[model samples]
Target: MSGGGAGASRSDARRNRALVLQAARSAFAEGGLVVTLEEIARRAGVGAGTVHRHFPSKERLFAAAVTDRIRLFADTAQDLSDVTEPGEVFFRFFASVARLATENRAVGEALETPELSAAGGAAGAGREFVAAFEVLLRRAQEAGAVRGDVVIEDVRTLLVGCLAMERRRVAAGDTTGVPGRMTALARDALRPGRTVTELPSAPRRRNSVECGVCGAPVAVARTGRPARYCGGACRQKAHRARRARAQGRNADAASAGRQRP
Candidate 1:
């Protein structure tokens, strides 16, 4: 009888915890991070003490929610890995995540915030998510369905940026089809044979942007110091060009001096 009672109690605890998590996710989505434990408990139909028992603080609770969502996404991606159509599976999962993030704006915001993202097992889950995502990306790349130049980080950035833009559209009262359009554009960008879209595009950067030597788009460093050249190769090339010009000018000056003498 005691064993059965213990089992039942554990089950109840698990159910209560899940309920609290679900309620907290909804509350955060609607009210941002300011939603109180009491409000979450009320929504979950549990007492505040129960919420506290499961999650010691609001940050922990939010962290748990973020990690839980990430794990679910990772699991889903793992399940889709065996599917024959790698490209389809990849884009479908991408679209699904964008839609999920769009619906749960709080999660999206949390993901964007570095401090919040690093809290409460979210980082661990992120590593796992990346591992799973890399599998899908690898399969697609091997199958020639996705461009070889793209990496897992690129996919993550693209999806997060899409969701962030969608959130901005909602905030600006232009929410219609933002998720869908952004996702479609992401899909198009990822397709094989398409020109790889560079990260931190023109809109996201400023300063003496274009590389003077290589003519490639130069990325503005986040730090105050901006990049002058695209890379080491360009810098070396420019150095050589300057040295050649200096030698030519010296030769011309010496020739003029000799003629005058």
Candidate 2:
């Protein structure tokens, strides 16, 4: 009877542990690491005491989450090893990860945790990601698809920049055109020297003004290039101006009573 009781208790503990982990994963994916422990417990249909018994600390729970993601990312990379175009695979992998990180602040913060950074298994996956990236970079360099001067570190920096930009966009609640613009910037940054052309002239603006539509700073027009409007607002303004001029002419004629006819 004692043996059977002990076995049942152990089985219950194992089931609770699995339930907590599943709940943690969902919470982190939805609300990030900052999501409350109480929330996790509630979501898991467990109590705070149960959560503490399972994870002990927030750091431990966060570490577990990161480890889960690292393993998943590694498995994905391994599955793509046979891809003939390594560079494309490399860019796609990081780009997708960056997008996810942008959407989840908790995962992003967990990535910066020193404990997670120092973990041997986690560090190994990072090294593997870099190694795979290098393989693709080398192939692109050899094929003259990417600039010869570009290195693996440059690609890493680009990924970081992409993530930062995406985070900023999410914070500002302005996601329009960000992905497409980032993709274009990445292509421009990595393309071979021959594919890039020197601009015939610097983009000209008329005056410095805040663009009403996008809220970006706009430059005034120059000699050859007339500054119209910064974005859609400028185009609309120009159309309105033309209509106003035509209306004024009609009004004057009506006031003159058709030349006293």
Candidate 3:
């Protein structure tokens, strides 16, 4: 072959490979593992033969796609390396993972696969991600922000559970408040204060009254000075009620005094 022809062929091959990878990423993201190579090739402006040349099998392609995504996520963590707050970085990383997993069923399925798990059995990116989490967890505990009992393993378990619960809620079409509730629950669970246990018994109600104006449930302050009013609005309403009652009592007294006279 001529020198120019050989160089052109090599350039074309590199372009084809890049195109295939880009198309594979988009297709896997949009259609999951069932995405067709023919469709990927079409999207890449190439032939099915080109895709097969780059990735011999669907398994190989899927693995490549997942590796690419993991590298992207790791790069994101690297970007946050300058962040001084370890807990914030840690939760941010998990939040990204959760969002990615929720969007990609293939990624979720791959995570659950025993083969992939065994591939990272002792050491790999999975172990590294766990290590990164440990750094954050230890920092948070030292800062007295997170509970000292919360270990890396606990964080891992919670992350897995959060993903599962979020997926379940999405599938059930109950995604309205899932993110806020999940975040609140996670924060409470990781907080350094007293551990709150969920018992089988019904939740204890506060022995307080509801404000008539705003309908807010008002509990006695820990200082033990007040009864039911919580804030300015409720306090103002209660004050008005008291004034009306006193005026009524004064009027009745005046009427009785006049009758006696």
Candidates' C-alpha lDDT = 0.78, 0.65, 0.65
Q: C-alpha displacement of 255 in model 3, angstroms?
A: 54
Q: TM-scores, in order shown?
A: 0.62, 0.61, 0.60
After superposition, the stretches of candidate 3 with alpha carbons farther than 4 Å from their true spots are 78-82, 106-127, 175-180, 183-187, 194-261
The sequence of per-residue lDDT tens digits that candidate 2 reaches over residues 100-129 is 665656555544443543354556665665
Can you list the residue pairs that collide in candidate 1? none
Q: How do the residues 117-216 of candidate 1 rate in per-residue lDDT, one tens digit apiece?
A: 5676887877777789888986776566776556676788888888876666777776465446767876788886676655343342545576655345
Poorest 10 consecutive residues by lDDT, candidate 2: 195-204
Selected candidate, larger lDDT, 1 vs 2: 1
* Total backbone collisions for each predicted model: 0, 6, 0
Pitting candidate 1 against candidate 2, the one with the higher TM-score is 1
Cα displacement (angstroms), candidate 1, residue 79, comes to: 1.2
Report the Cα lDDT for residue 97, model 1: 82
Off by over 4 Å in 2: 110-124, 175-180, 194-261
TM-score of 3: 0.60
